[model samples]
Target chain A: MQSLIPLMRSISGAVVLVLALSGNSVAEAPLGLGRAVEQTEIDAWDIDVRPDGKGLPAGQGTVAHGEQVYAQYCLSCHGEAGKGGINDQLVGRIPFDAFPFGSDPGKTKTVGNYWPYATTLFDYIRRAMPYSSPGVLSNEEVYSVTAYLLYLNRIVSQDTIIDADTLPTVRMPARDRFVIDDRTRTESFLRQ
Target chain B: MKNSVSRRIVVQRLVGLGGAAAAVPLIGAETKQSSAADHSMPEATARYLGSYPSELGGRSPHVELKRRPLADYASVTPLQDLSGTITPSDLHFERHHARIPDIDDSQHELLIHGMVERPLKFSVADLKRFPSVTRICFIECSGNLFTSATEHTTPQMLCGLTSQSEWTGVPLRTLFTEAGVKPKASWFLAEGGDAALMTRSIPLEKAMDDAFVAYAQNGEPVRPEQGFPCRLLLPGWEGNTNIKWLRRLELSDQPFMTREETSKYTDPLKNGTARQFSVVMDARSVITAPTYPARLERGWHEIQGLAWSGRGRIVRVDVSTNGGRRWHEATLQGPVLPKAHTRFTFPWKWDGRGAELMSRAVDETGYRQPTRKQLIKARGHGSVPYHLNPILAWIVQRDGQVLYRAEQWL
Candidate 1:
């Protein structure tokens, strides 16, 4: 049994070395099951936008054009000037320093007070908006409505022209209020 | 014993002499009268043959278990009606951002692109060709907090957004490896094909760990409500991260910060800071049997429930019958796999006195589940929105009625 223990230890050490060398790659030989995909094919489905404005499309929208777009497609659900209706209130800023939504159930979390990134507004509206009809808006219309909502939130002025380069530069009110998850496994209770 | 035997013999002699006539009054007037109208006798039932075989089978006609619909978007599993560990595929909880999409498996395709040596697209058939793996784990919603507790609330109504199943799938790491994932790729975006096009950013480390693209659940094809052709299954992570009806995987150096991850699912703390990507569900347990609405009789009973931890296996579950003043170690049912629901039981007797019943779970990580008061004290009333795993207590009245001890922090 003593001799067997050394042999087992050596085998386990070799296994660890193999794992370390492989890194994220699987150790097994590739099955080569899937077919290669082209970039254009990926582009059609790649609609996600990052905080640093990685995937924003080339389109410019003014707050004036955005008002018309919001009135036409977003007014019914989001209400007049995004003050809120049956859906979520897209415009509200109860002193960014307050951060009372966590405790107050009556407080509404709008795009202005809760969302951390201006790019998220574009990503969310472009992917999911109008509740009844999603992905129906043109990229130009999505940018316009995003700008319109931002204007209502008072983050951007009515004259601000929101395009690919300018949208990422727009700082959100709740940007600095967010933190990464710090909950650890060792803690028997949640960290305060 | 001899006196009872003599009594039984006298009764048998009387029954033998006058069959139905002598048994009528002794058996009770209600049963004697109802026997003539109802054909539910054991002898009569045994004489008849059962149902014939069919192409599709269903639950017994007498049994009616169903998922409770919260709204148009989600439905909760019937936890109290279940036994053992595996939640029946049909009864598994459903939480879809949009309506359930009906996609033909032949037309479904999974595209893996961005930050890879070779971007690949795999069909459902192609994925099936690869070596498959099976695991039994749970998917719990981060917002599965049941704060509206009442006397009528059952275990199903309290916390039923979690359910376990034997999931079979291709390990996501194999697919990532086949695609030759670049060393720079730290996170990946999982996109769904539903109308909402639900997307979530997942760490690549998790994808290489236990995450998989599940194609089957409980020995059958994944249901339409549960990401039909294939779905990403991140064991122990928040249910929303396991993107259903998976259509795309875009590897990136950083998180995409999608709407689901940002505007929703994030945990908000009392100190003005919200926690993003708080994915892992903490340890939680609930006493399913003898819970709310169960009237007890003065006799011996078994306290049965389930305990699970996302971090690891449930090492211990303590049952307290006296409002946590005393806790007895529960007997964990065998096959306690990691990241899975484990059944636990404790023998208990009712002394016809009012008592409070509670169960607390301790995971392999040595993290013990906290009571409602402890949870409130630590996180404050503001953190009541998500990831709530506080100990649930039930009050037994002197008259044998059970009710939930609902806590109010807000």
Candidate 2:
């Protein structure tokens, strides 16, 4: 009986360790099926670009070249020079101080008057654009469209060539107008 | 069908749009008149085949999801066509930004990297090997209601953006633990493999709470429109954020502020300030039975509809026959699941008079569904069309006619 005490204690200790770290392991899968994801695999699929320019790929485009690209691929849905069309109006001059939010339902939310980050426009156009074909835009074409739209919105000059470094730093006019959601704070007002 | 066609032929003969001969195919052509007068036996409809070869047959041809006309890829669930809480796997509402990708489940893989100790790649088979959980919940589009719908609108047309189903899958936290997430991670980006490659940033806390990667919805593999192979099911969150065709998850210290979050879903407020990441859906209910297009006669009418909340379970559902003047508690049919659509019933004696009927849902968190005025007051009059869960009313006139009170919001 005395000799079995150590064996019982060892058994209890092993059970405790297994219980503590069961499914969540570093090198092992409890069921053992999948393998490690390499950096190359991640780069192939992780195409999401952030506002801070962290994920913007290496590319360059001029506003002049962008006009040719926009006319050919983007003009029908986005309209002439991005005027109001079947889809959302993309071009509008931003009087940032006089921006309207609620009183006008018809207010055109342009890149200058609405979007907070210049990188967002590039990221969006690169990913989901032309209304039909997505992920077909070349990196240079994406940058060019980003440049052309920025120029149309009067956010940048006509000759501004947008690349990784220049596009991220372009300050959006309505950047200050966006705030972290305060719906929880205002939820009480819902009752009243 | 044959009887209806023959009856329609008799009726059409009086109208003169066409003769009875024109209505021959309207009913079963096989079940034609036996002699001169009529009276033919009902023909055999269809035989049970071994299996549907390619395209599955719609069991009930009447029940159908009404696709938005000439917009994007968007369709609303048939709420009036459905009864009870669980929405059929096929009838689930679809609001895809781009085309639904035809994902090969065997070739599909989810890559979890960025700010994790061990970047793990998981296959569908690997995920199934882990512990699984089943919960009945709803995935609702943030923009559920269109304020300008006409009087002919049915419950499906009104707010059919929401659908409930019993989702079975592995909790995301288990995967997060497997990946060994870093302590500094605050937000995680969920990316899909559709044509648009849709992506949304979710708070890590919310993902760890009850969020799961759902493989099967309502006992079968998740439908193509509702994300196939696997999709992230954030119970009660907006349908856009519950990304379909989920491909990758990247943990980060800050939100990615993607196009969907930045320029689109963000609500424009009264003060010229756009509200970002306004996530959880508030409590709301609609009386579907006595609503628009559904005629009601003066008598004891049992008002029935669905009430749901993203916050938690619905505690009480209050109903009003005479608009906001008088209110009564509705009998919430149990067992009411959390973050799910709960059915409610209220018996009311209609007096054959012009009146307005509305329903108010109060969730477990003491939040009552707001009135139109309250919603407008809270979110300016021209608030962007997202998360608009205002208490709705149906106008009933003395002539036994019902129409949606859609114009009042304007």
Candidate 3:
């Protein structure tokens, strides 16, 4: 009890000293300590749903609902019917040619033909979708939209359900096309 | 009397907060330094600024040069902390697949052999002997927009690959005349000696225009991260085109269709096709200061930002007070170099008005900076994200709070 009193007194004195120093500036503290992050505060910004379906939430939606969601949230930028707007086309068919260069004419490659994993679509959309409000969609909504985009790209049937289980299994046409970068001979020749 | 008591409590809290904030650097130092040995002046590096630590060769002394997510995969430039258009070469962000290799300039030679009338080899010295031209230009990476995401990506992603320099080098034309490039050769392969063995094929016409075999940046020899000894400087083109540590130039009838050109750099679009060979960076502008995570005071402040275009020079950069509703031309910092980042500034009288602000770049080519919407409209929403040079806006509240504005790209 005797030691406790001295410790408390010292802590209070330290706090008072700090209070005196910080009082000189107005543009110092923001949101106040009360509004400052609480120890138990959940970090909403750390949301990153991986392509392997790590952070996906559980919910259910149909292609019909996805069409509506796509129109409401995604269509303005991505375009209606997934044809594409000012942003990238989320849905498409047909594999890229041997000479798929810039997004020039006669070199159209899309999700159905190029992306190796269907889960990549779900992960990318959930994390960075609608362009304006990313990470704002529900899991079921994300699944439904993924299903709808797959259907539009001719990768999935219209009635197919897309969930964590089935997303990895959904085969993409250009899955095996990508290879790791190789610069061995190129570098050796340059050294000479 | 009760109000005064509450006010005193608030003042007490404020004082406590200020002291805590001030002590953050000290606490950070204790946490940031891993060892006691690190505390002493590295003994050898006292002549240099900051701790180059030998672990990371290129680092700035200023605390502001530090980027978030300090990792090997990529590093962001401290755009908000920088002042002039010319980014201190040391502060420039570096993203390489492998470690930088040291090349002996004495032994270094550029071989121009394939598809030419006369296969020629020019040593670093021989290449410099030709008529050399020095010009300031900006080199930006194709994937510079990764940081412009809604969740405030770091400056590394925003415009890390982009850098301005008064590169001194011999023009490709001068070299072409010596090598006697065949007319049938439409494209040329530029190969690098780095571990990634980076390679890219560029059109001969573009090469003949303004490309050069650069050997210097700013006033010094180029850094290893920048492809020292020799590097190709393709002004206004994607940074990848400016191959560092360049060694070979092989002329060909067609592009080698390297993996980088075919699979990596290409942008997939709505029509199920990809856009390739699109090298020129579109006009873009960003307010470096007062960006995310930076606070400001309410007063007369100078709005500063960087503007650039791949097609040509930045003629004017207009600032928007009420978002994009009202626009006024900002004064561009002098000696605006072509194909380089032109520093633009505007004096603003902030009455603590809660408003959204943005700047739009206008290039000499007369192509006005596009909004996210305009870019989407032209490129298609299905298009892959690359070369997205939209005007970035920052929302400011009366309390001097600034946040990246997630505007409508469409």
Candidate 4:
């Protein structure tokens, strides 16, 4: 059945072909084009971490260690304690009730005020960070940096140990503020 | 006095004989020497043989079309200087998070895995062997809107981040079919091979519909800036979602919620909610010619510009010579494919008085391009930094100078 799925998907009149094949009791056949990938190969490339922390590697990091990682890596571009310098600001928080980002140009969208998911920090820092160098951070380093940023944003305390289990549990302040796109191709320009 | 009278008589006779006789140098011997310097003697080109053709072709030295670099990471297309719909592959607008990575196509491979009936790894060669599809569509960044408008702003400087191309590649549906997607799989994560390893999550329905793995642009191998070996082409979606340098696809039940989708590309609204996954660019049009620094004369001129919509084809583009009081239907150039840039034109006779010119595009979906006021009213001030598709206005002054209206809201 799995082998026949490809042939059925490729052809427009697949229903008729499937009926004919079922009558003849013939075996299912695939196009036999690409080779099957191994789990190890998949694991090496699959670096995406989901909101539920599904793809997170088995590692733990503390805020104290995260501070060291921040000082070595993030201080120059992100400023002392993530106050901001040249690149994007990583710290600072707006009141959860106040969503002034839309009306005020002066409001800065920092990690604490804008990001909806804590898992995103781990995913982004792991895949692309340090601006000049990316994909160089170890899983521990990524977790530590993620902890440090979260700590600075006041989402987590210094005593907390961040791991795959605990990272997803940390609720971001802007989590509920995001809504799916609600645009439609109607004559009226008004957004609901 | 006698010599002057004789020359005048010769000039009169030459005038009587029309322009052909004037080139005969019948006045004096010095007339022959000065004739070499005459502006209308076919110049000096006919006197010498032209250069032979070379291995590669290039634009004429007289043509000075070029892409303007917006910053170190991005460069904008020269929209005002271009004609027709298809943007030249080299001059296409470029916006990369990191630098363009040099890739060897032979070594590149695409891996499709996770929740699939059969996880597969296919080389570039393998993907090309499958049936190929070609399409013409425009890829526009969500942040394509250039708000830093001034009187000196050109169309390129205003909104040049969008570009159209004829892409040729295998449809993603075919590859997914070969891999045999699981029934539970609803979304897939597209990851790039660049240093940034840029990633975006797309719904499976969109992948099955019009998405293709494009390897060629404008009948040539994709440019390095445009993801050289291969890239994903999601017709009508925002540019970033059509992940370039595509290397992997992981099927899943839910979206991975990548940084590009969550933190950066999302739009904030006045209602205290940020809109996520706002992919489609609404209908928009802009007058390119007789705009900004182009000194115009009071005679007949064709008002030309480009209009496009992500939802569908542009059905009508109305041009207004006066400030939105009266509008005339502009002629649309044929072969207007869906989600492609459509060229529109309207003839106008300028009376040397100050006038504002604007164009409004209506797509097949009946979505008319909104005015700046309408956009601001709906989205609120400073709320929408992305997906801004307001109709742009160009002011033509009494002194025959054209400038961008540069509204205060911008």
Candidate 5:
């Protein structure tokens, strides 16, 4: 029983050592510390160009290149003019309140009216586009299609060069409208 | 039990069971007719044979009941179609934020760091080496029934995003011991390795309670879609809390407050306040078979449904014949598990009277499932679109057709 003291102390000492080592490793690791995002890494993943122009990639594509890209990749479903016939409408003056299908009775929410960020357009298209084959387009192809879509939405001119520097500055009308959801407290009370 | 049955028979005679007995005969005829008519829809053809005509292996037949594919998610096991509580692993509902990552078991590692005595990286084999524990529990997505708020939604659109499976893994305490979690750590972040890199902050108390790092579902290695190699299993909580493709667990004193928790899973109420970290699923039940797109024959039919609660076991499930006018207790199947879907049945005979059929779940906490009107009154009718599990109503037509009765929150 007398030897139990050293054994107990030794066990605790080992535990303390393990704890200290783990603490040091965790503090040293930069797993998800929200560091100052690098420009190169930001450019790679920052495909989302919000309405006010943020996180847009570098490089530019002309309307002609965009037109060719659209026909090759998008025209199959989005229609030749990209006005949307069989699929959801991508072009035309969007009246946010009007319903095109009338079958749903729900208001027709289009990209021009509801999409709060221009960055989302690039991001979404880069990630999942063409419906038939998503994530297949190259970065340049994504840029061209994005330009063409924006031109179709009537938000930008046909010759407007969209790159990383100018993409984040493109002001979207819905930018200020979409408020971050504040529904936490009410949901709790209702559940309670 | 036999004595009680005899007493019930005697009581039935003393109460002049003539009227009630007559009602039973009428309902019986209605059931037989409906069964004869509902054979029109291709019930047998609806069985999903796993994969999209592409066999990546690891598929089973007993697990293919209520399966529907969406953008990045899928529906659950049709509890109404199932006989018992055990959900075959493959048919388990999937709710993934990003594409399933193909993780090589050899390279996969679980890094446990932060406020721990021994921050350690455990390989897949290492996790299996720990004192393993197997448990039966249900994991459900918080947004499981986002579309089920109205009558227009099908069961697939309703609360079909939850599935129960026998999870085999190491108890979290084992990993905690290996990593040596510090006393000061109150919260920990579970991060995934998908493109979205989903992360959620979990309380240390939950980690100490029933938390586990599961590597196998049912009797085999975890399915790729259900987070192959390894994932965190928070039994009874919403699905998102159980981080899939689990790669990192960082113990901390504060919440990480990831975008998925703040922006996506949070529920927006009528008061314009969006609720965050609302992980527990309330008690709910839905009749799957005789539901939308299924026409009935109007005869003796078994009213089958599933009832579950995140808090605990579903103590009772009440079925209403004439809409919400009157209610009768349904018979629950044996081995009713807490936090698992419990199958219930009520043998009913319908008389071809155009009526509305619905079921309400009552949990051990005595919280009864609320109707659309009641839910709207509490949450307010607006454009909020997540965690909506209002009582679902199905309209029975005289022509033996059953359609989902869509309701609006006005």
Candidate 6:
């Protein structure tokens, strides 16, 4: 933390000062060339959903309603309850005993078996799914599909409703299976 | 001799006609039609003449990537067909989660929103107007080497996911200046405009460091396949985080944990836990030629390959002729730039006996690439299926047939 003290000045002003300190030629900067983005633009594009459901828009969905939405949109590519598709598999997790987390690596990586966060499902589907037409789903449609997929994986019941509140609270079975990267380039992982 | 006589006649006739229109033959003239048989034929004579007028270029007929079977979306670069360090822009390897989309630069906009004093949008033109920077480095997929691939395979098949190019762009910090990033902002989510809407959360410090908003690759506007119009250039990082076809960057205090970073790119350890955000691709090296399909006649031969490290520059690359039994330092080609591919070569004499050929690279950081046994032992037998860079072994038979010493690791 103390090391960053020299870089703590205002971003624009600090850049030149740091350059000058390093003996590089420091030039005064003008305001950037981009235009100020409108709130409407941000609202339209800021669709990423965090694990805590911070980015999920206001909406609710039940597995019952999700079934219809799934059938109408997601059923073809994800195919017959998200199993066996041309693109990727979203259902049918391998048994824990088979791989035991990372004991034996396999080719198959279904959403239920590998994904650590359920909000990731909602976030991905909302932004890019139904392949041919992404980002066209309403908040309701997005919620329904997320619910249907969760129910298909047996993480949620058919009667269970999902919203911003209930969505992030849903713990994924593999949530505890992830670790932070610890590689510093000199680890024995590469020092054979 | 005939062509010279015809050329002299034509030139003399042309010169006689004020060095002009005499060379132009009438459309239906028999003499002009007969000139196709002359060696000095200047007009189209054969069926469908040749490819006309172009400013840029194409590869020699021999250059092509080895496409992954069944997976129509990805292909590996033909490293054996190339010499020196830089990969020709056309032959660069490609791995797309979704097929390449035909993006319209006119309609495209890069929006930097979220925690900021003034959330701003930059057009392709606006980005080009900023203080631009050009750099030569490599962009490599963390998931480059495959375990199942074996000998008789091309270099592209062994490891073709990484490619080096001269990238031109606006410094990401310059853009951050315009937006006035909030002090609390720690991470920024970079999203692509592809069909998958590929996303990853990058640390703000990395953005302020060496990141760029690249718009050109290899002296030309970026290739459509390589995020044309624009892409994020996260120097020395895994290829995934340098999101291609960049469309948005949202700053926040925490990582967005997008699907690519979580379920896809994470590295799972043997302890039932996976490593999240393992974005740094470690040191790796591989021999390009004198391998399978490339038969060798016993004599003087040059042992050569490519070496690179995402951590820094490659300081040493050791060549082993008799497997890992005997090792010698390879001649390091000059301009061993940091985070860029460095070419290494060694002169050798084949004794006409079976031997194993291998190369190990040690980077400036003192990090050495592991052997197959070491790599698997350290990462576990069934480890995460990415960033696998092990010492590759090629068995050279006495009969001069080169074969891959295929061993099970993953």
TM-score of each: 0.88, 0.85, 0.61, 0.88, 0.61, 0.84
| Candidate 3 residue-wise lDDT, B1-410, digit = tens | 66457645655655565865645455454444445525755445446564434754553454556544345555667777777878788766666544466999998777675567666667787776676789888888777875325636434445566667778998887776677788798988787766545677799998889999899988788888888898999998887888889877777776655545654576654444556677778788888766766556667878889999887888999998788899999999988878889899988877788877799998886777777775666556644457777788888878777777764332
TM-score of 4: 0.88
Instruction: List CA RMSD, all candidates.
Output: 7.3, 8.1, 23.7, 8.5, 12.5, 11.8
C-alpha lDDT of residue A85 in model 3: 83
DockQ of each: 0.41, 0.41, 0.02, 0.38, 0.05, 0.44
| Residues B12-96 of candidate 6: C-alpha lDDT, one tens digit per residue | 7556755556545632353654666665848555676778779966755775544343266677777776789988787777878
lDDT value for model 5: 0.69
The regions of model 5 sitting more than 4 angstroms off are A1-192, B1-66, B72-80, B146-154
Query: Order the candidates by DockQ, highest first — what do you get?
Result: 6, 2, 1, 4, 5, 3
C-alpha local distance difference test of each model: 0.88, 0.83, 0.70, 0.87, 0.69, 0.82
User: After superposition, which runs of candidate 2 have C-alpha atoms over 4 Å from their true positions?
Assistant: A1-33, B1-70
Worst 10 residues of 3 chain B by lDDT: B29-38
Write model 2 residue lDDT over B280-307, tens digit each, in one string.
8888998787777766777988888999
| Candidate number achieving the greatest DockQ relative to the actual structure | 6
Candidate 5 docking category?
incorrect
If the candidates were sorted by their TM-score against the true structure, best first, what order would they fall in? 1, 4, 2, 6, 5, 3
- Which of 3 and 6 is the better model by DockQ? 6
Candidates 1 and 4 compared: the better one by DockQ is 1
- DockQ-based class of model 6: acceptable
**Model 1, residue B232: displacement in angstroms?**
0.5
Give the count of colliding residue pairs in each prediction.
0, 0, 34, 0, 43, 1
Model 4: runs farther than 4 Å from truth? Answer: A1-30, A185-192, B1-46
Cα lDDT, model 6, residue B231: 93
Flag regions of model 1 displaced more than 4 Å.
A1-27, A185-192, B1-46
Output the lDDT of residue A169, model 4: 95
Q: List the residue pairs that clash in candidate 4.
A: none
| Candidate 1 residue B378 C-alpha distance from true site, Å | 2.4
